[model samples]
Target: MEQAAKELFETVEEYFQTREFKQFFHFVDAAIYLAQQIADVAKEIHLLLNKAVAYYQLGDSEVAVKTIRKLQPFERHMTASQRIRYLNTVAAIYHTLDDTAHYYEYLMQAYALATDMNEEIALLFLEGNLGHYYYEMKEYAKSFMHMERCLMYCERLNFEAHEPYIIGRVQYINTSLELGKMAIAEAQFERLEQFPHILTNHHYVLAKGHYYCICGDKQRAYELLAQVIRHDGQHETILSTLYERFLHVAEEVETLEQYVETLETYYHYLGRLKEAQAKKQIDQMKIYLNTELLEEMLWHDPLTKVKNRRYLDEKMPIWLDEQHSFVGLLLFDADHFKQINDCFGHRVGDEVICLMAERARQFFSSESAVVIRYGGDEFVVFYSVKQLEGIEVMLAQFHAHMQQCAFTVKGEVHHVSISIGATVVRANVPIEVLLEEADRALYQSKQQGRNRYTQFQQHA
Candidate 1:
């Protein structure tokens, strides 16, 4: 199945290179089928990413974003290359929607990751995108720097004849023109034109138009720029800038009738751009809300509304690595929880569990701690000693609070007590070791009394 998946992935890449999105999706489906058969989560995520990019290339930005969101849950499972691809694909989708905030967010994320990996090809995509981003942001100097870096990577990787290199050249030329470096821009433009089939590139045409517009060849600039607008006007950023450039030239050097015609076309594209922007705003809002809700659902326990074991499993390593002070791990278990369920039924037992969770949350609310529902009738409180002064006093206060908390069922009052085992360490340690020590302490608490707290102690 792995070999079959690999072949399917290679075929998908071929289709992607050819821009045959339909065929690309077919291979992706086959790869996903094989991935499911083998429970290959990484391959599945990679295939889904390919699907998202294919949809994006087909101009379905909404579907592309949705597709990427579906992979959020398994993002941690992605290998380094898969993660870079995911980031670049997300940036591309956001770029298509003119979502500057999200576009730059993902673009910079990919750039940082690529820089760390020292992956030249990955940097090729990221640098070109950053060049485009700064270009649209009107940071001409920064845009020029990124485009130059992109071309440098292209030359180093022997990708000078590739689309990314071509686009980088075009953007570099346009950015040069923006910075008033007409001589350099003209020189780069002539050099870029030497490449076979470069004359038909939309971006090349746009750059040429900018050149002519700058040289005061108004008629030539109007013709080339207008051609780009007609062909590539669906790209809002490009269309907006091209229209503005074309209008300046038209108003200056064209006849009154020609200028009026240009104004009418410009207004049409302007209206479309506004409508597109409104739609993008709506889509972005929905994506943001949905992503937030999904993250909450993934991380929180539905019953107790605290972090769940999944959250601990995923976030503990990251938190531990970032911890700079002593750490405390406390494990709590409801005493006689099973007996309560057996006597009063599961419903009342559930209510008792909720009551216990609420008390714990309130007691720890003042401390820098995260309460986690580790398993049935078991909770874990992870805290930092730096933020929490006097941990023993806080634990005593919590015990008092739990003692005072009572639950009533069918006019019968019931008191709930909990046993806690805690361990604190001043040095970095494995979570498994902490858990084992805490569990031993918990056993001590259960031996001494069911309704007490025990701290782990090392005997010499």
Candidate 2:
């Protein structure tokens, strides 16, 4: 029976590799039927998991979730490794469903189990997955941390010949560039030179393009990036990333013609990508709406319509755990907020808070920064800072923008100012300590002057 099951699984795997998804499903169904007939619990669980993966790949996440839930009763029968695989499968389904919170949740669970078992390959895979997740989130520091771990593990396990090790190297190069770690990126690029075939690999090409672009060789960067687009333009995520890189270099280059041409190409690709994604999301939404598992509004702040304290509370620990090299936290307190409420009424105060939230949102890139309405008249902004100068420039821009904002209540002109306390989080610091330090800085800022900003000083 085991031999028969193995043969059937091989056929399913072959169909999957051939991109014959329907045939893959047919084989999986047959395997499940055989397992049921033979009353092989282990075989049945395996086939069911495969079926769930198929559903996830087909973008039927609702069905995938139901299929995975069917394995709950067999949880006690699963080995630790099998349980880890099960958790990862569920995480992948959540990722397909666009449920980032749950995706991270399950991935972390699997990571913990893998760590406890001291499973080198499992740890490497989880680290790589987490690195990609943070990379997509534009949390470059955290992304770099995980990708660095992947490289370390690859070397320790002598997995340099493996495909994932190559991919991990590519990702590390890309993320190191993002974090402005040019030396690290260049070292990784040289390492890739050992693998001649990686020169033509799309990810390697893209990373090299970014490295060159950062090193002030826009022409070479453009050539490599153009090659990537020509070969892998259909991949929306890759195209989007290339488009963003184009936008970044557009400002630094003296010539506009080539940049404009690349922008046009990127715009065309992005339009097609967005259209396809929109349709897919619509279909996903229909499935979600039909099911009883409606998403909750727990993460959003009602008044400002931004992320709430709960969201920040949930995410901050993950960022800290990843040990980002430079995490910047800014605590903003509306200056004289009580006076505004007393003078204009609570409704007007609410309007001011909303406007302030909107301006805060404008000051930071949505992909990299998180703005939370921490409490009444206080907002917290947390973002990964690639350089100290970047944080300074952002602070200056934020201060200037606040000065420009003017509000009118009952035809009376009013100007508002915010006291900001900023701090760079260091490695191994507890989140509570980080917050306390920022709060102390905020108090100092208020004491010095309500309208100014203060950087946290450990001695002061």
Candidate 3:
């Protein structure tokens, strides 16, 4: 009888040490079954928790829930701190299930228990979890405060090793900024930027952009907004709001008011005229993204694109209008190009135009240049020249460069040249009128001599 008892103890010890549950047959085998008959429910509960964690990692949330439920009888046997921890794990499972109500309730219970037991780490995680729930519910004030405390706890506890906890600081800063709590938001936002891993994170950059927006620095806001747009141009709801807000604030500055007016005027001409239209576009964009009305809006130009127009409208306003000085626009015209369509096939003519457009793009100095087909054979080179006198000289160099390239059609080489109308923009000039003036100058170049560059005149 003693030998049989000794054999049972050795088998149970091996079962616990080996995680024999990895095999269904072993877990359900005669050995564990015999041990289960002998041992209390608490030891079973402990083993079940470990199994549940493994199942949760495998995306088997249902099974994890079942395991947790099966362990409920063991809760009475656990100590105070262990019970709190057990509840927190259950809360986390609810999170994976997206049962937000259960998640919050269990988290709150764990937080209460942890507070009662004086377990600081458990309370910190619980407070942060509850704050996330509140933030999702749009209860900004309390959410912001609790999250602020979570950030402080992470800081005080030296939790730099955990990235998500640090990111909670940025998340709260964004929530506060949205709520218009600028003073506290600014401090939180600055801390958020200093979070050691800000460079690569979307949330970090967005927090910084919102900081600039909230601080009423429209120039920096636009700049950062441009960066965000470049990195992820598809998130139009965010990009549109940032652009509109930047434009709104820029309009308020007396120094920028003239150029800002021009910027809106250009957008109006581009069919984004009214505040109602802008708002409608945003709403449509939201619906298109949400309801599959459009799957890939970013790739198609808002106006005309086999390519996206967002790339143009987001950046060119500031580039051509000169929020910063020393940028140039070279308006290019297809030489007697309209006559070609009237004489030759429009298909042949379109092929020629596309070839000419490709040639013009090859002359760019940086990623700063945007070549919009602007409608037909008329194209615009909206670019910034980093070096002085570089903007004007670029056209001459482009013309010289174009003189050498040949296009092949049906294996036949075709030569094409374009008239260039260039303009330098100052912050004082409105971008719409400036571009219009450049187009007029472009016409003058075509009349006097095709394949030549002309600078636009400033109206008094």
Positional deviation of residue 352's Cα in model 2 after best superposition, in angstroms: 68
Model 1 TM-score is 0.53
lDDT of each: 0.79, 0.78, 0.64
Which residue ranges in model 3 land beyond 4 Å of their true spot? 1-47, 57-59, 209-460
Which residue ranges in model 2 land beyond 4 Å of their true spot? 1-6, 13-20, 57-63, 134-145, 156-158, 178-180, 231-238, 247-264, 270-460
Task: Kindly report which residue stretches of model 1 are placed more than 4 angstroms away from their true locations once superposed.
Answer: 1-10, 223-247, 260-460
In model 1, pairs of residues that clash are none
> Which of candidates 1 and 2 is the stronger one according to lDDT?
1
How many steric overlaps are in each model, in order? Answer: 0, 0, 4
Q: Candidate 2: what lDDT?
A: 0.78
Q: 268-328 in candidate 1: lDDT tens per residue?
A: 8788888888886665445333564566679988666678999899987677777787788
- Model 1: residue 333 alpha-carbon error in angstroms: 33
Model 3 accuracy (lDDT, Cα): 0.64
Q: Candidate 2: give the clashing pairs.
A: none
Considering lDDT, which of the candidate structures 2 and 3 is the better prediction for this target? 2
